[model samples]
Target chain A: MENRVLEEWEIKEMLSRYGIRVPRGIVVESLPEKLELEFPVVLKVSDPRIIHKSDVGGVILNIKNYPDLKEKFMEMKRRFPDSKFLIESMERQGVEVIIGVIKDRTFGEAIMFGLGGIFTELYRDVSFRLIPIDEYDAREMIDEIKARKIFEGFRNIKANKDSVVDLLLKVSRLVTDMGGKIDQLDLNPVIVREDGAVVVDAKMVIIP
Target chain B: MFEHLLNPRSIAVIGASSDERKIGNVIVKNLIYFGYGGRIYPVNPKNEIIYGHKTYPSLDSIEDEIDISIITLPATMVPDAVESCVKKNVKYVIAIAGGFSETGERGAELERMILDKIRGTNTRVIGPNTVGIYVPRSNVSTALTLPERTALPGDGSIAFISQSGALGLLTMDTIAEFGTGISAFINLGNRIDLSENELIKYFEDDEKTRSIVLYIENFKNGRDFFNVAKETVMKKPIVVLKSGRTSEGARAASLHTGALASNDAVTDGALAQAGIIRAYSETELMDYGKVLAYQKPLYGDRIAIVTTAGGLGVITADYLVSTEKGVGMKLAVISDENKKRIRDTIVPFGSAENPIDLTADGSTEQYSRVLEILNSERNVDGIIVYALFQTAKVDETLIDVLEDNMKGKPMVVGILGSKMGKRMILEAEKRGIPAFPSMERTVKAIKVLYMRGRYLKRRYEDGEQGS
Candidate 1:
């Protein structure tokens, strides 16, 4: 309660309370002798101390088999010995979106949504609203951002509006339910496939 | 600190001079002319008497208790004046002199000297290089004069807090022209001791304050500000006009108020999260404030526009509906059944479908019918009436109809011509209704009201969860 920041797993648990979908994932400090997941899984260092896993080469994606997974896991451990690891099922890509909450000086806990992955930082297209956004407000925040046009079917791909709205609503509800306990929560690269959406990766920081 | 600043009864004007050009002289004149009921003493070592009132040579010589002392002396003399006021146990001091921290390092040192003098004492200082406060209700005008005495001195609903003294003065003048008064006006220049967040917290419990407006350049404490704003907004509407948003603005702000400006993205995100309406311009700020301050909060976002002209009606309706795209609110005009019934009862050719455009040949009776139908319609949450006041058949009769039907519901009137619209505008204001000069402003006001209304509803619902 003293810290307002939530860890990644805690954020996932909170989002689960709001009925948000996330990829099947499990946390482990050490690599298991026998891997349970199928081929083409994604594994990343899940240490709360590490903010950017890809920067440190802690993320190993598209592992085709068990040998590849073992080799990548060993490499990741060798590179970062103290870091915890998370094994998650790789998700199919349709559209990528980033959703987070940033503590603002003038306005309080602001929820943000934008086009995700590299486009999010490169394009810097995002929309924000005050925390505890209702269902209507969540829908509005999604539509207000410039990246919303991409969600309305960009180029040849037909955009999934329902999934985008659903994601925003759930995120809003998550932030609302967490109240002042959560400082910042980032769910990047939320894969919005034709049928549904799943959060592929997340980072949460508790304020001390 | 803000409470002591705003509610001070007895005041002393330092650097009191007989010359009208001096800041001290103007402040004394403003306080006296504005009819400050409390005792006003002039303190000047040089002048024996200022404006025919006996001036005290020093704070020690003054026998009466001073709740607030205004320092309008030179930069070098400010420390001594503050020392004198502190020794006299003055609770609040508003330093109107310039050449403080805003100047440079040397001036900043001098500003620190002033702050050091009042550090732990009960005495709180407002500004060392700033304009001062204005409480029309108390008839306290401590700022430098501009010719805008149009603001009525009564308990008003809007409270304005600005980082810039000049902008605060300008806003006072501008809002006065709109015939709206303010409960309290403050300029928190440099915010050396008092900040916007503290003022907002004070306003949260203020019964006289219905809506709060701010012109902020930077936030000294972002997290503290957010927490207070989030809580305060649940009590009253908070509208912020945040300047220094762009890179150039940030640089300029640093020079203006010594504000370490943050990135625009962070500021925007923060404002959105706080549920505070961020206005782009002074005009928009006042427009939003007027709607939030005067009109009753709307129950829903569904607006029913009633216009005399088809083109104007269409434009109004379009703007109202389009603005709510992201907000997910709907605006539909009165239905055909209600429209036809109104037309048959009032005007036979009035067009249906929300806008309820009565053709050019329509009369006051048609306007009345449209209002009656919209009032009875369950789908309509609010109404906007656009009338061509210059038309031959159109007269005060439409105003009368509006006056009768506009009770317990929010409605805005847009008069076509300014010259002929004055009478109607006055009448509307007298009736506690807002009348805009243009269709664009009318639509914008309605949109703000709708947005604010929705936010308020959400805040209340969220509050219930906590209870």
Candidate 2:
């Protein structure tokens, strides 16, 4: 089967349909007259070909006004001539974590939950389980990570563990519902606040 | 389900020989020495007497119907031998020779031929390169190792299944030396036919088996193995020691999820999800097995440490509370009323804190009284009693005290390793109280039981939530 990565907006749209929270975003071929979103928005090139958008200057964040949004959108469009632009309201930072699903060759459809960024890259602190998981498995995955102490309130950060569990259960269901169509799905830096979790960035690889 | 393989009424050693060095001789000697009750038929072309019993020239000559056949011939000869076993209608065949699929293409062809002969027949095969099985309960053993070299365990509850023959035998010896008994030991060399999944289901219903331990290098069907294990663990605990844990899967990964997963890390989670305790070493394999087999699941994490030595008490407490190395068990707080009750049992100098030190001069009666008090405390979920037999007042009677106080809650013993300590451990095991030679091992065994408890609780809630 040929695998293809879906555009970020499409992936986020799919996530929201499964009852997962995603940033309110829009994809446009050109800068719009006025945006429906609030101030302080983010503009990025929504091309599946670009994996690390920020690494290649495809992303510009924290645009406080429509003028900056329009300026950054034009600049991003100029940098990537063939790509469409994605504009969204900027989100406040929270505890960063990654939740993903991969159709594993051996175990098949396994869900992964781990701390995002350095904890994932350096410490490799993560836990996994075969998909179609229930509330019990979701709860256990939270406690299985090495830095589980973070969930109970680490210093100034107050991460809601229940929201993470809810996100995990929904992802598990999404993968289960998609079945063989999804090869991999990553919700990197899923901002987890005391109130709830939102998929700040998403990249999904689907079987075409 | 595998009655012919597990509880055969009669067995035939096809490559029966008189030479002491041969595998056939070792198998025959093990069977006779271990006191197998069923008929033993030795088949060889040479019509001679062997092991004080008449040998049949071929399997067909055994008129009573062979329940199983142990084929100890060369790889090239295995297919032909299997053909004859099938002709004789043998229910199961244990081919003990190597050089089958494990060798190369020629061997693979032989394995296929062997498989072809058994297809659509009532017969089943265990291995073309395997040491086969050892069941102490029925006095039946097909292990290729010399019986005198290893300390064979007697009939007990733990059933071990291994993919490697030598490791299985070596661990069996260690488990035996540690005073833990075995219900059965099966080696899945090359896994030509029977797999661990089937044995898991069989042992789940076996009256003699209380816990199942597996050492698998790879899986024939991982999903089926896990699914069967998930169902069986609700009835009995299953522990697995899976090697090759390196993150080989990460190199080929295209995403962070795949990259973060070492095949083993995913396997570890899946095993836990299925309620199987994962063991990292052979010692840990039996350590977890013996405890899970003998004791009930520890339903809570609150642990109380009772020791005669203050230093041992302090270390045990550290191990229980250290989340870095330990399972982060809470040091149970004993109420003031309970402390007063324990204080009256020990000497004036003895401390009645969480460890409840009884001092060096603590007596057997004092240990028993303190344990009785802790066992009754609702806050204390489990108890660890570190007994120093060298103390003047303590003796083998401490084992009886531990056994008696083991009524309402779970408890383990930590004894210093010595000649007397070995005897105490054996005695404690005989009475069904898991006693370890070290404090860490004792505490870690409790962690395994605690994990089992948590899994059971999760599963119970799963059922309560309706699936």
Candidate 3:
């Protein structure tokens, strides 16, 4: 396996190589002729340099078909001309999880995992452990998150426990392997589907 | 400014009067009282002799090298006095005068002038309205006021920085009373030059400072403070007591130091993000400082409470378990089943469940029995014992029991009773056990210990995963 700073596509490619599931998508620098996916697909600016796409109105979602996708793509292109766009099939129902690395000045690299997608910052319900976490440590991180109850099948929703745990361990391993080379890697919405999980969108800040 | 303030070889007190009531006189007396080994220079422009030492007219008249110049003069003449000391090449100047910055516009302007004069020079000023600095390892205290009578120079473990001069002095007095020594005590009054964050970064690598305690009313730069704190706390435990938590307190802090008290919730979140423990009160500040100064980090939340009184033990257990989502731990009140296992050696009446209530009539022997049983239990990660020495029957025995049983356990003790009971509590402290008179203090201490333990366990578990 290559150990270098990976861009958005490069990271997804590496994750796919590691047998981790990622949302099927295509990157386009311009508006596509016609959308290939079904309705309710996600369109996001796919520049690795842009960490928070939603903050800058760089994401458009739930387009029904080709007409809607073309209109949204044109609007996004008008706003961020230099940015590449990614269109992927959306995972409608799944628990959102975030996996990232924070370089703790004293202890060096620390991997953090918790409930994600907007609520992460609002609740700040995250747990941190040193990098290269194992399955047991990943399980402990899941338990420490404030939304742990939700992950335990709360509110008539059965959580995909095995997939979520596997995703956390894989993210931890990826961060440890990258070491100081990657400043931060955020998989904001790792959807925990009923039978499996998928990394829908992710970003990484590489050290210059 | 004199070089002796930071690296003092020889020091002298100008205007060092014999009178104990004046600031000048107090400086001279405390230096001798703290046992300074260097040459003593007591200069009073008026008196030819003071404190049994020949008084010189000024820094110019002093024949020897003056590394430090501590000026305690009237506000108007301070600038001129500083200039005289500058000519003498005094590298460190600790201006203990209070009129500047604290006495309104004119004083603030005077302070600016002082700063302007000191600029572009090797001389650094500690405070214009300050309480001096203390280096315990060298028996040096440049502050005008002395700490509490009980305080002695000890092996330094914690470095303290305070924005308030009076609070800094008060904290030193408190530390002295508690028999804890500090590596350094810095009072950043008005913060005309140095800042709390700079001191934090300085102490981050200092071998003498094991833990850092900060009493801050405001931050010069909140983001910078957060980043430095995040880095520092992971290496050394950082406990902070932000004084202006309430609106009223914020107003008071603003008037005191011109600090804009940020919203309490935001500050709390930011502090937590940096892993800095926010202490609610002065009592918690000292209590946590003491705990973090000594105890090892806890590994888990599971606690085994051993108390002579059932009520106190139950209260402690309830607190440990009762959060928003029911009880966090499965509290086992030392039951008869576990008691039976140790009954051959211990008394039959002792409860064997988690809160091992040895009964009110419990002696040190009973404490030994309960501790031994709890320590042997796999579920117990730490222990909190409430030892009440109400009568002579269990007083001596309790001390012996605690001394023997509390060898390696992460334990905290709460003692409840009158003045004599408080004395017994101090004796327990003397035997390497931190005993508090109030149950709340005991609980808070245990919680801090538990927090540290959790930090350690998290690191250990994560380290294993990383490996």
Candidate 4:
């Protein structure tokens, strides 16, 4: 079966269905008259073909007012004429970590947790476990990383470590339910704050 | 399940020869030399007697029921030989030949033929391209490797399972020098029937085996192996030295998770999650195995260093806390009361801090007293004793002190030097005390014990919650 990357909005909908917290967002073909969400929103071109949306200027962050959101949405619509636009709430900056799921050829479905953004590839500080992990396994994944000190109030950042553990178990259950149909799922830069954790961006590749 | 295979009462050596150079001859000689208590039937049509024993012309000719059969013929002739063993209702067959599935497709077809002959019967195959097994307690050694270099180190707790015959024999050959012995060693060449998983399950329940060590290049059935390993480790610690860690062995992946998931990284994580310790090299494999087998798991990472030389104590302390090579252990704190007790036994110049230094004038009596205090100390989780024999007063009597102190806390001795010192190290190992040549090795071995301890604590806590 051919693999396809799910669109940004589709991934958010899937995450919410699995009880994972994602930024409140809407996918619109055209700019609406007024915004229902709070000000300072994120505008992005929701196209499945775009794997690195920020690299191609498909994402515009921090629109302060309604006119700015409308202008940014129109600009993104023109840039990718066939694609829809996602307007999301700009999340508060917090501890950034990446959580991913991949169908390993030998061990089958496995989950990965690491320092998110460029650090995910730069330091390569990640830990993995075969899916259907327990609370202990999730906790170990968090502690195994070299940069694990980040969760324990690294510098100015302090994250709710328990929320990350909760996120891991929920994702494990989600991947376990999806089974062999899901090839890969990446929740990059999942902003883990003192209060809770949110998946700021999600990318999924499925066998269907 | 592998009673006949492990400790056979009677064995038939098919294609057994009188020539000293042949593998067949070596098999028969090893059995007799190792004092195998069972009956031995040498089967060869051309010879009436081989190795000073009456030989049978064929399996049908032997009146006694065979518990196990060793086929030392070439790969092409293995099927017919297995066919005879099956017709005779032999329980197990150890096919010691080189050519099989390891060669190519045609060889795999030949292997399948051998498998087909023993499909419904009681017979099980060990290898068509393997060295078979060695059980010291049963006095059975079927390895084709030379007896002199690959002499079996008499019975001990570690059960070693290797995928490569030569590597397995080499490790076995050197383990004796390290003062470690194997309860059993089975080489899983081509893995037609018995693989590491089966051997692991067998050793888990075996009273002789305390810990299991594996040298696997690639798993035969990875998922099944993982499942078995997950359950087995809760009972006993399992250590693996899996080769092919480089990126060259990695599969090209399109997704980020797959891209980051290199062969070694995934293996490292998977093994850890299952509570199986991974060793990067052969030395690490044996070192981890020996330590896990001999010592009880530490309760925490806090460690105490007892040494005759202050320099050795300092070096050990450095390694104990070294971020890169260390396993996150700290210099154990001693209460003032315990510190005064240690001080009263040692010389005037000796220091009584975390790395308790006994100075060059330290005697075996001092060591005995210090170790006794440390063993009773609540702050210390484990102890690394630098049993330097080069000192004036420290002599062979220190080995006795180490043995006596071995009961309460996990202690590893670091001793290295002339022939006399090496013998002392071996002596300690024979007594089930882990002793190494260098401070680095001693610290690394302690790391393995610490890892096992941490893993067991989590497993037990989870179990308690469940119940």
The prediction achieving the highest DockQ against the true structure is 2
**Fnat per predicted structure, each in turn:** 0.29, 0.59, 0.00, 0.50
lDDT of 2 by residue, B323-408 (tens): 88777889999999999999888899999988889999899999888888897798999888897897788888988888887785
* DockQ of each model vs. true complex: 0.23, 0.68, 0.05, 0.64
The TM-scores, one per candidate, come to: 0.81, 0.96, 0.70, 0.95
The digit string of per-residue lDDT tens for model 2 on A35-73 reads 899878888889989977888998888999987777777
Clashing pairs for predicted structure model 2, backbone only = none
Q: Which ten-residue region of model 3 chain B has the weakest summed lDDT?
A: B252-261
Rank candidates by lDDT, best first: 2, 4, 1, 3
Interface RMSD of each: 9.4, 1.1, 13.3, 1.2
Model 1 Cα RMSD, 1 decimal: 5.8
* Candidate numbers, best DockQ first, in rank order: 2, 4, 1, 3
- Lowest lDDT 10-mer window, candidate 1 chain B? B252-261
How high is the CA lDDT of each candidate model? 0.75, 0.88, 0.70, 0.87
lDDT of 2 at B240: 95
Question: Considering summed lDDT, which 10 consecutive residues are worst modelled in model 2 chain B?
Answer: B246-255
In candidate 3 the C-alpha lDDT for residue B323 amounts to 67
- Residue range A50-130, candidate 3, lDDT tens digits: 756787888787877787788888898888888888888877777878776655433445566767666776676777655
Q: How big is the RMSD of model 2?
A: 2.0
Clashes of each: 12, 0, 21, 0
